[model samples]
Target: MNEREKGGVPDDALIRMTLAGDDGAFGELVERYKGRAFAVAVGIVGDGDDALDVVQDSFIKAYYKLKEFRFGSNFYTWFYRLLVNQAIDRWRKSARSAEVPFDESWLAEDSSPPDGFAYPRTPENLARDRELGDALQRAVDALPEYHRAVIVLREVDGMAYDEIAKVLGCSVGTVMSRLHYARGKLRETLKSHREG
Candidate 1:
């Protein structure tokens, strides 16, 4: 079948197909979204190894619970919520604390940024982006769980407020409020890095 003939052929549609005995369709969905899902996982758990485990578990959970997923809703928003809960569970299992990564051992040692990302991709600029990303991540990690969730959903996931509200099981007002505070705190924390 051509792309259009494959129904709407969206990720959700593929998932529905998977539920209907098309394992290949499920594999397609995994190939399509695994990178994004992994990025979200890493962003949350702050460790490459742990994030990989989360991503694997997330795929398993999504597959088994495919029947439970509501139709006509944003697939990614739903998936993101599942990821957040999974990451939180993993965190609780390991740390038994709600504190973000900076205050924890995960981030304490890596005073330097990642290997590369100055995304001018020049050595200096890449180093700067990594520095900023690292510092920004620390501040982001410090947000209250709800606020952090909103900011990540909105900014990183590019989810609309309504979608985020749906994922978060909160009102748009609550999403906006948490987002406002989250942004304000992030700005305050990263002020030194901002350009004039």
Candidate 2:
């Protein structure tokens, strides 16, 4: 059984139950979305610990704001809006404070690259691939916050344009524009890195 089936309640039903004073219903919501939320958060904040904080804070905010949620809308989209905004804010604060260290540990953990390519078997190729991955990540980090969000939401999460537009509180056109600009910038940065 899927999680919702196992829980025996849909998200709206769970929200209603929570509104009726069943805290467990809300807990189920958290359990359902926390992993995906963390992935999105990490993609934006680029730091696992900060991403954790962002997820926790977003959940807490979501809990308090549950009453404001319009029934029948996708709960994840609403929650994702909060999560993305929180991540961007956190990223901005960290960026302004000092250099935010890029964590390469995630790179090591995944056997394949984010682009779905298998890692090179040879040691030399592996090292070069690692360098390319590092450069790509650094290029992504250098993107503006909204551009980063757009790229991560589209590329990493594979969210549809309309869904991303909803999450980012932008029009579909804006989402497309940001994504185009972000990709162009990354290409330019990576090209310069290669040529240099």
TM-scores, all models, native as reference: 0.75, 0.84
In the predicted model 1, the residue pairs found to clash are 118-125, 118-126
The candidate maximizing lDDT is 2
Candidate 1 lDDT, tens digit per residue, 33-138?
7887776666666666787899889888888888998888877877777887887677556663222233223234355546883323355755565677778887
Candidate no. 1 TM-score: 0.75
List the global CA lDDT of all models.
Answer: 0.74, 0.86
lDDT (tens digit, per residue) of candidate 2 on 63-165: 9999999998999899999999999999988844222344455446554665866665676865666677767778788888999999989997889999999
Q: For candidate 1, give the lDDT.
A: 0.74
Backbone clash tally (model 2): 0
